[model samples]
Target: MSSSKLARMAHVCVLALAALSWGAKTVTYDFNVTWVTANPDGLLERKVVGINGQWPLPVIEVDKGDRLVVNVHNGLGDRGCSIHFHGMFQNGTNEMDGPSMVTQCPILPGSSMTYNFTVNQNGTYWYHCHTDYCYPDGYRQALIVHDSDAYFAHDYDEEFTITVSDWYHELVEDLSTEFMSLYNPTGAEPIPSSFLLNDTINTSIPVKPNSTYLFRLINHGAFVGQYFYIEDHSFEIVEIDGVYTEPTEADMLYISVAQRYAILLKTKDTIDKNYAIVTVADSTLLDKIPSDLQLNNTNWLEYNKNAPHPQAIVNVSDSTDLHPYDDLSLVPYDHMPLLPEPDLEINVTVYMKNLMTGYNYAFLNNITYTAPKVPTLYTVMSSGDLADNPEIYGDFTHSVVLNHNDVVQLVLNNGDTGSHPFHLHGHQFQVIDRSPPYGPGFYDYLNGDPVPYDPNNHTAFPRTPARRDTVVLPPHGYFVIRFVADNPGVWVFHCHIDWHLSSGLAMLMIEAPRQIQERVTIPQEHYDVCRAAGVAFEGNAAANTKDFLDLSGQRSQPGWIPDGFTVHGIVALAFSVLSAICGILSIVIYGMADVKNKQDSVVPLDNPNEVVVEQNATGQTKT
Candidate 1:
């Protein structure tokens, strides 16, 4: 073909490709989850209704700028429901904040609300009901927004979403119709012995022999931390909580509630065989691991003994295009930057008590049992000097006080049997350290005399510092986190549990140096109208109205600067001819002194003719 014809053909192909992959295509998904009675099993159950009947809904995807309108029809006739998109910035759209009763009225039973918002962020974020615990199962789903740039896109042979959830057989409503029942005196309904990984379906993703697959793991389970591992393969974690991390290989990871992780795996095993994707309690963590962990062992020892090396449940196809959203990683929001040194340390205690018995009510600190009323060593130190001073214990509060500009170092202790997923609002934090009660032992210290962790040459990674928004505080374990108290609003910091929060397990965090309340601008002459309507104003009321005050050009803060000595104004007036001359003289004097010192050190290069002249070819000595 002639060169011109070849060029024309190439142009046509380029245009065709561009047309096929031009702008992002918009997508919207519909879902429904409802409470149902369980048979024979003697427990309450919830099944996903609309899309694929699964709890915690499906993984829905959209590209940046895609207009998404999700209409959640609350079918749980018991109470109202609202879906809050956690960690999502709706560009200050209050409606998108999804406050069940505050931002907008909740979707009452037999009614539905359309949540219209643009997908503007690319990271891991989720949507869950923001109402009472009773109506929870129906209102949870994973919403993923893809990055705009194509280079960051991922490629995988196969992909599947792993949604881990904790189940309770009793309708949260049966426990207590009143929302307060979540924390009331009655014991919580029996929590399931085993958690579900992906709606209780035997997890099996088929891949061709020697092919790689991707797993998008999302943890929205209320209580415990989840650790997932493939039966035979160590995976590469490429993304975390929806943000891509610097890729690293690990056998497993600890996933707290409301967080997500994405891992890639390459299997050398063949297709059409069965393999187990095992999930176990991160029981080794400081906190209590569930006693009864159900592993998928249908065929048991026999299958393990003679099963082919590369096992697969189904024939995997070429999935190179499945990881459409892989390259999208966690990009920092403008407000998030490397934090400055923290100025405050808050050590909050987690406790468990048998409401019926006073004996069981105890405090947890230093991996031992203590009376619940007593304070920790840090608390005593903070209160005052004497260790056993009555005054110190009398007025002492466990909470850490913080000023607005103060950076905060929050230490969370999970001393109870149940794990707590701690989340901080208005800011993300960096995880600095974690120490399980057992330290370097197989069992927790509660079992007595645990192995000590070594200070050096230890493979166990501690203090693996990284930025994170949510962290699972394992039972009988502790974590240290640091963040700046920058965002001034009343931010809620608590376990992301509808039940735990309502039970007084939550506390208020006050950011001091309260934001200065800006002066309200009232329109001029409006006050007269208000007075006519029986409203009164002080001092030239009518003139003080917004429009009048603005029109009069009153200084926003009249006393901000003393009458004639404005900071910038004085500085500008001082830079006159005299000041300029003085500045020039200072520079000249400094330069001359430097030159004289250099000449004095030279010793006049012995004999001018034989002088080692440090000069340019032009014979001009250069400095």
Candidate 2:
């Protein structure tokens, strides 16, 4: 055998022995969440969420089968916060899967909560604030799960994690006021002020010649999806969103918000020159691009310190011109076959419409997601046999109860004129079909009505489809995904865009509530924080313990606008018309009075057409 093959075998053996030596252990972190100043893009400095008095929060690293615990204390004193491990299948520890008002209440100012769970799955994932409008202010970081038994672990010498995000100059709270206001009728997302690479710009990552490196790429931005490429280099895709996929060669990748990709890159043999790593923001997603806002950023892969590092030369007129390899073409490494005919199929259409308040809001089949008084998981735990009833979770939440171990097929049609990255909380799903595939034809339906999926008339589904936790739904197109409801938890399916999510583009999946109750238990710390935040831990959606069906005081979205003029609209129109008439009448009266006064003062001459004015003191003929 060749020496290279022997070396690879030796490496694999070493990793296997290391894995045996380092068994599962508990990893704990004490985080004091506070505000700190940072200027990642070098243009503006602003307050950002920091852990333990540091910005660019630490990346959490752990091995498979290890128990991870994080104790969080909210010290911002104004904002509530919670951390959601992005792609974890929390399994029996459903309460540890964090999402404000979905599984647990937000950790309010001065309150504390602990997230404790085991990491059974291995690949790339992240952790970020799940509270409403909280993560954009630098509250996110990458979470890596190291696996010695991975299919391609022996192929790389070292690994690196790089995060790309769209940074904003203003805080999310300030931006949200204008984002959800009547002034923003079209629900246009706030444009990012700058794009960041590893939370900073113009940096270098050192590398050696002729070495293989595993680069894990994460798009932790709030709104924009970015196209990533290494100039003059090609990488092999190995994993996506915590699911290991068979190696596929690609030169460029488009990563949407909250999505991840791991690629293996082999460096060139010579170290004379350095190369640029480029990330270009998707201009199609931006409503308006600012001249000062740089759409593309360049970082370097340094081969030698003495070599001249240069900026990347972009060759495309637009980001869309750079066609990335289609992720749907990938096949999983394990080759999990396509699931059987779904036991339940959910069909929902995305819509953006103006409510009675004149503000645009997102909806799924005419239902905007509204949070219940009690956390949905709490409602499920407290309610006994009625937990199986979806009605108990309230209408506004758009709750759907799933049976244990049932195959669920979800068909999402985009009626709106924008792309949305939909993410499921607890499970990675197989993407079966998508319309207008990811190349030049992605925007084919932008000018027309949405195309809903017709089960009988569509492209053939893949036998072993690619699995991912987040999938992007195209503009006015549709996507179909399926997964088995094996994990019993209150998972959320929502758009990853913070603006869209805050506008009610989300829904709840109450999977196996009976099993959830039997297997999961809420810690006292969770209850304490909920009580401190004035949230109910028991009862139905409306906090009515007496009657699970009573939803009289439940919170709801703003009322919808009628087809034509509404009552308030009619009253305002009449008031405006009356005011205009009175102003016009006053102007006419003033003009007539002035003319009558002039007639009274003028002296008439013998000719009817002529008139005389007052004579001067000198008494000359004044006519």
Best by lDDT: 2
- TM-score, one value per model: 0.56, 0.89
TM-score of 2: 0.89
CA shift of 36, model 2, Å: 0.4
TM-score of 1: 0.56
Give the runs in model 2 whose Cα sits over 4 Å from its true position: 1-22, 565-623
Off by over 4 Å in 1: 1-58, 65-67, 89-91, 99-106, 110-119, 135-138, 148-152, 176-189, 281-338, 353-406, 415-417, 437-464, 484-490, 508-623
Candidate 2's residue-wise lDDT over 1-623, tens digit each? Answer: 99999999999999997786578889999999999999998899999999999999999999999999999999999989999999999999989988999899999999999999999999999999999999999999999999999999999999999999999999999999999875677788999999999999998999999999999999999999999999899999999999999999999999999999999999999989999999999998998988898998899999987899999999889887878888999999999999999999999999988787777889999999999999999999999999999999998999999999999999999998899999999999999999978888888898898898999999999999999999999999999999999999999999999899989999999999999999999999999999999999999999999999999899999887777875446446656777899999999999999999999877656898766555777986555
Residue 155 Cα positional deviation in candidate 1, in Å, after optimal superposition = 4.4
Using TM-score as the measure, the top candidate is 2
| Residue 156, candidate 1: C-alpha displacement in angstroms | 2.6
lDDT of 2 at 569: 67
lDDT of prediction 2: 0.93
Write down the lDDT of every candidate, Cα atoms only.
0.48, 0.93
